[model samples]
Every structure is written in C-alpha cells, then in structure tokens.
Target: MINRILVVCTGNICRSPTAAHLLREALLGCDIAIGSAGLGALIGQPIDGAALATLECHGHRPQLHRARQLTAELAQEADLILTMEQGQVQGVIQRIPEVRGKIFLLGKWQGELEIPDPYRQGPEAFEHSYGLIERAVASWAGRLLLRR
Candidate 1:
C-alpha cells in the first residue's frame, strides 16, 4: 500500500535526496513513487557538493536532483513520509497534522538512527551521512517492497 514515499530533512540538498535516490534504486520497478523535500530548503538548488561527490563515488547519478521545500500538498500526496530525525517528524506534524500517521523516521529499522546533515562540512561528514542513509534505505526497501 506504500505507493508514494517522501523523504525529508532540513535541507533538500543532502540527506533526503540521497535517501530518495537510493530508495528509488532499491525499489526499482516496484510501482512506488519516491521523492524528497526539506523543511528549510534552498529551493531549486543542486545537491551539496560533498553530498554529490559521495553519491557519485557510489555510482549514483543524482546530478539532476534539485532542492525543494516541503509543502502540505506534497505531504498529503505521500502515502509514507520518512524523516531523518525525530524533530523532523514533529515538524511535519506541526505543518500538516493530518500526515502524522504516515510520518516516521527513515531509520526506524536501524534503532531509530538519525542521519546528520553534512552541509558546509567536509567529505568525511558527507560520507558518514551517506553511510547511514544507505543503511536506512536498505531496511525500508525490504519492508516497502513487501507491501507492494
């Protein structure tokens, strides 16, 4: 029943987009629609350089990704909304209370791990965040694919 998924973070340039791309690949051809947005997005901006480099290092071509702000309509359209941290879960609820039931931590299966932001940081920080996002995406992919 998870046909639509939205990944969320503070800025769309990093964690959320990374998770979305990885999830899209993990759930390839599964009829799921994956997207990402940010609570305070640098709207229309490209992914952060460090984050982009990290993704490219993993063979993912996310060059076309652009940052987008989270909106009520987007949240409403998603069947599942995954956030990078617990605060983000509450943030989504504060903006769109109706989405409360569908919002959850992206690392729900990894002991509720919270993926950190690597914006303005060095490659090491971006690499660490990417690692966490990868693990969370793998865990969610299994559960989501099973629902389809």
Candidate 2:
C-alpha cells in the first residue's frame, strides 16, 4: 500500500534529488511515485552539478531537477518519507506532526547511517555521498519490491 515516497534533505539540490531519482530507478515500472524536497531549499534551483555528474556515473539519466521546499501538504501526500540524515527526520516531524510513524532515515535499514550533504563541497564529497545513497536505496528497494 506504499504508493508514494518523499525523500528529504537540507537542500533539494544534493542528497535528496540523488536519492529520489535513484529510488525511482530502483522501483522502475512500479506504481509508486517518488519525489524530494529540502527543509531550507534554494527553491526552484536545479540539482547540483556534482550531484548530476555522480548520478550519471551510476547510470541514472540526469534530469532538470528543480529544488522544492518541504511542506505539510507534501508530507501528508507521501505514504513514507525518507530523510538523508537523522536530524531531517525531526525537521519533517516538527513540520507535520501527523507524519510521525511514516518518516524514516533513508539508511534506516542499513544501520542508520546518515547520508552527508555534499552541496558545494566538491566531486569527492558528492561521490562519497552518492555511494551511501546508493546502498540505502538498494536496501529500501529490496523491502519495497518484496511487499509488492
């Protein structure tokens, strides 16, 4: 019954978008909708160039991803919300208290490791973060696909 997933991070440009697209690719042909947002987004801005490059390296086609701010409405719409960091889970819950049980760390299934933000850091940082996101997505995708 998990129809929609929302990935969250500090800025929509980096971790969240990368995770979102990867999740979408992982769940290919499934009836689930995936999206991402930021707690304090550079609204309407395109995904970070480093992030786009990292995704391309991993075989995911880059898209014109525009940053969007996280809102209560988006939280309400998502069947499950995944955040790049533990702190982000609290941020989302604070904004939408009703989404308590539905929000989780993207790495929850992998020992709860937090995916670091690579915004403006450099290619190395982006690459490191991308590795973490990839693993997290794989873990979640496995569980999701099994239930379907």
TM-score of 1: 0.97
| Segments of candidate 1 deviating more than 4 angstroms | none
Model 2, 57-80: lDDT tens per residue?
A: 878895679999999999999999
User: How many Å off is the CA of 8 in candidate 2?
Assistant: 0.4
TM-score of 2: 0.97
Candidate 1 lDDT (Cα, 0 to 1): 0.92
Q: List the residue pairs that clash in candidate 1.
A: none
CA lDDT, every model vs. true structure: 0.92, 0.92
Per-candidate alpha-carbon RMSD to the true structure? 0.8, 0.8
- Per-candidate clashes come to 0, 0
